[model samples]
Target chain A: MKLQHYIGGIEGLEPSSFEKKVFVQPWEERIFGIHVAMMGLSSHLEAVKSVPTKFNSFWTWGHLRQGAEGMNPFDYFKYRYYEKWLGGISGFFVESGYVTEEELSTKTEAYLVNLEAPLPSGGEPAIDAQIIEYLRVGDTPACDVEAQPKFKVGDTVTVRNPPPVDHCKLPGYLRTKKGVVDQVYEGTYNYYFPTGDGVGDPMPIYNVVFDSHDIWENITEPNTKIYVQIFEGYLEDPE
Target chain B: MTENVDRETYSAARVRALESLLIEKGIITGETVDKVIDFFEKDMGPFNGARIVAKAWVDPEFKERLLADTPSAIAELSFPRGMAGAEGENMAAVANTPEVHNLIVCTMCSCYPWPVLGLPPYWFKDPTFRARAIREPRKVLKEFGLDIDESKEVKVWDTSAQIRWFVLPERPDGTEGWTEEQLAAIVTPESMQGAAKVAVPA
Candidate 1:
């Protein structure tokens, strides 16, 4: 689908003059004052700037500094938008929507600090950190070549019931699915990385088969099937 | 697609602006003038990939190579290539045989093989295609006038992610010993996606 469709019709908080006043302060000054005082002072000014235009333009800057110090500057900057806005004296950026505090802290520490952020939010940070670190060290050797396919064609397995998380490749439509292994395609490559960027190294992968009923759950035809060849990165050990 | 506007000056100006940006960014080096001249002179696109498929139809060995490693095989034709030196994903060339034909679809998003195939069709990018392709590939093919016999197996490949797929359609008969050029004329983009079959002019 067009990238435009994905970002379609989603408007966020309009930048007020107060935000402009807050943003105009020198970058260093804001950081310094915020770090020390933990107070935001600019909240009343209003301005009309196309948020999407600013978001797109800001992304280019982040891309320019790609992989710098093992940092995904884009996500870091995105979360920082939330942090600075929320932590800003004018108002909190977290009021916008969808972006969580845990996501903000996780990406910040992973990319900005360059150390494994102790994931207090359990698997979310760990997974985020892993993806980022994997992207940083592009084209690395397979970590678990032996943890390879234990199931072969004709083997029946149930797709693990995993909780929904934001910004995941696993489409909400398909979760906790069960399907037969139609064909065990080998040497497939998984592209998932810590940075959540498509720009990363490819890793070993596999393909699984799902009967149409399993995927859609209410399909009229029981025989129909959808064979999806995903990289090993997306799958878990058969339960 | 015919030009709707007669504003030649406006059209030329936009092209010039884009060319200037490309040149300033060092995207193309050496004789840049020749590249611009060539861009208009020749249709540089996935049609070249269509031509390769046409050639493979007449040559068995080429067909074998195409199925094995489509990236290297099509690179021989020198289509407008991409920066990814190595094949980034599963760039497979599945041929449509007389008995079994291959169709391409992306249920999630339009994940195309841009290196081999140029810009995708408008429908491929349409939400209708993304939503319907997986659920009703046969019905969609029928709408495209591709009626598959029940005896023949039709495989609709769902390339919703990174792996890019392109179909190598079965060469239509009646053009016996037809030259690659002649066969290529019959190869349409729809044929490559298994939505339509190549046919000789009646």
Candidate 2:
């Protein structure tokens, strides 16, 4: 099992920081913007109206999370949040043949010498506009399918134990546990792409609530309830 | 926090290089990164969430609609566009009452309500927070200086699916007659995340 997947209920780790800032490092903001821009310009985004940009690859949060989830468990915890983003995203550009490692490293060396070295300028303003447009008019995954929900509100369902994949939406701790459906969401939702386990197609998502004692037993706090939005694919009739 | 000094410089340079190369190759513009950052500051941020919560506090009808259908209720507001944008297509708000407190966490990756909340804070993204908060939310909240009495039920909402969840922190006392702007000013991001409570200035 990937340590990344089973982060919930793991013991002994202390709270890192109450650091309130969204971007801890100034450089983190740049990488975050780049990721968003990539998502906006992603070739697979059906809702976007398209822009004149050469970023032809299919990129999304699924692709980025797969990179981070694929890292060594120790390495995953060693790096800061955006630090992982920098490594994963830069690697994507390289692996996709958008840029070469040699070129990136050489530019790195040049910038190290002069941190304020001016970035090479000039590209279409349409590219930036499209990226912002994606932010404004998001590509929602809600589909036109009539609800064919298997479980209704108050149904006690067990989370299916699908074979673990690199990235999964099922919180590892919730697997095999029984939860009561608190709310059957209004309509169907679709993942951007199918995560090998069971998610990705148009299906109902449920707000399932579990007693903390049910999942963690005596170790959990008293009078605690955990509510999670889970895909219908990852849930089943309790065995 | 003894991070490698050269590694920090390397990362800074590396990201700059990535941006520069992307611009050079016509993948994104030189203005792309800056404009994206500006969007968060101007269009989407904690400021928007504060406003939503503030309006909810004053208008029980709007608050009722918000708790029932998050996107539809939020759409009624006059905030900048994109209330239902990226990471916010399906949103929900769980209200904090004296008996039940709500905390939002993504145990796997930091899944957050970006349009309403702008971005996940550094604390929310930390692995330790993710790991511990799911199982021991009361303890985690206590560490953050909010001693949630054992009598109060703590509901930790994990945003693992399409739905992005945020807390509708109870309006603080002595602010009954205040305007929406005054109420919004007291609502901090942490409070909206259920880590703390909105307090009137001491």
**CA lDDT of B26 in candidate 1?**
32
DockQ of each: 0.04, 0.70
Best by TM-score: 2
* C-alpha lDDT (0 to 100) for residue B30 of candidate 2: 88
lDDT by residue for model 2 over B123-187, one digit each (tens)?
99999999999888988888999999999889999888888899999898899799999999999
Candidate 1 segments exceeding 4 Å error: A1-154, A182-192, A195-203, A217-225, B1-44, B75-89
Fnat for each model: 0.00, 0.91
Interface C-alpha RMSD after superposing true interface residues, each candidate, one decimal: 20.1, 2.4
Q: List the residue pairs that clash in candidate 2.
A: none
Q: What would the TM-score be for candidate 2 when compared with the true structure?
A: 0.97
lDDT of each: 0.45, 0.89
